[model samples]
Target: MPKNSIQFQKSFSIPEFIQMYGTEMQCRERLFHLRWKNGYVCPDCGSKSYCELKSRPLYQ
Candidate 1:
């Protein structure tokens, strides 16, 4: 491997991961950001505006 090669490792613990994404909303938000790094954008209509369902991890 090259000197500049990157190393992959599991640095975070389960508790830490849960702390960051312990709830449905938290998990959804994290996934949203990962999928849309710039911001939230509608996949169906291509709109930037959206509303979250109160009882579920869904966007409308």
Candidate 2:
């Protein structure tokens, strides 16, 4: 190890991480893919389902 350097000798799980940070960028990417994976789209027909109240990390 060196100064100001970090290391990890293990693998990482993306799904586990998404569960941990759903409101994070990583989760947002997964959510976008998951939503479109099944070919589902929201036309924003006033249901407010696509509404994002803030600057979310994954909403384009």
Candidate 3:
């Protein structure tokens, strides 16, 4: 690894990580944002029109 490797950078402490993703809802929201930073986009048809399923943590 290089001296300034990205993995070696400590952006947040362990406590901070727990604080951000310490719950199911938190984790879900983070995943959603990471997946669709500019909003949801369909992988198949490349459509932005989609809906969230309340029965589970999923979007279709």
Candidate 4:
């Protein structure tokens, strides 16, 4: 292992991470954005139009 190789794994402290993503909605939005960089698309039919399920954390 190299000395600087581990630098790529650097991360924010616990407090800072919580301050940035402290809410359920914030975390969900972040995940959504990361998962769909070009906007939401249906994995089943290859459609871009879809709606979010109210009672669950899913897209339909």
Which candidate gets the maximum TM-score versus the true structure? 4
**Model 2 Cα lDDT, one tens digit per residue, 8-59:** 5564698776575657666666767777775435655423245445664333
- The digit string of per-residue lDDT tens for model 1 on 1-60 reads 555434554467999999879998798788889988999888888999988898976778
Off by over 4 Å in 2: 1-15, 18-23, 38-60
Candidate 4: tens digits of C-alpha lDDT, residues 1-60: 567866777799999888768898888888889999999988889999988888987799
Cα lDDT tens digits for candidate 3, 40-59: 89999999998889898668
Assess candidate 1 and give its TM-score to the true structure: 0.56
Looking at model 3, report the run of 10 residues with the lowest lDDT sum.
1-10
> How well does candidate 2 match the true structure in TM-score terms?
0.29
Q: What is the lDDT of residue 58 in candidate 3?
A: 68
Q: Order the candidates by lDDT, highest first.
A: 3, 4, 1, 2
lDDT of 4 at 45: 93
- Model 1 steric clash pairs: none
Candidate numbers sorted by TM-score from highest down: 4, 3, 1, 2
**lDDT of every predicted structure (CA atoms):** 0.83, 0.57, 0.87, 0.86
Better of 2 and 4 by lDDT: 4
**What's the TM-score of every candidate structure?**
0.56, 0.29, 0.65, 0.70
Number of the top-ranking candidate, with lDDT as the measure:
3
Pairs of colliding residues, candidate 2: none
Worst 10 residues of 1 by lDDT: 1-10
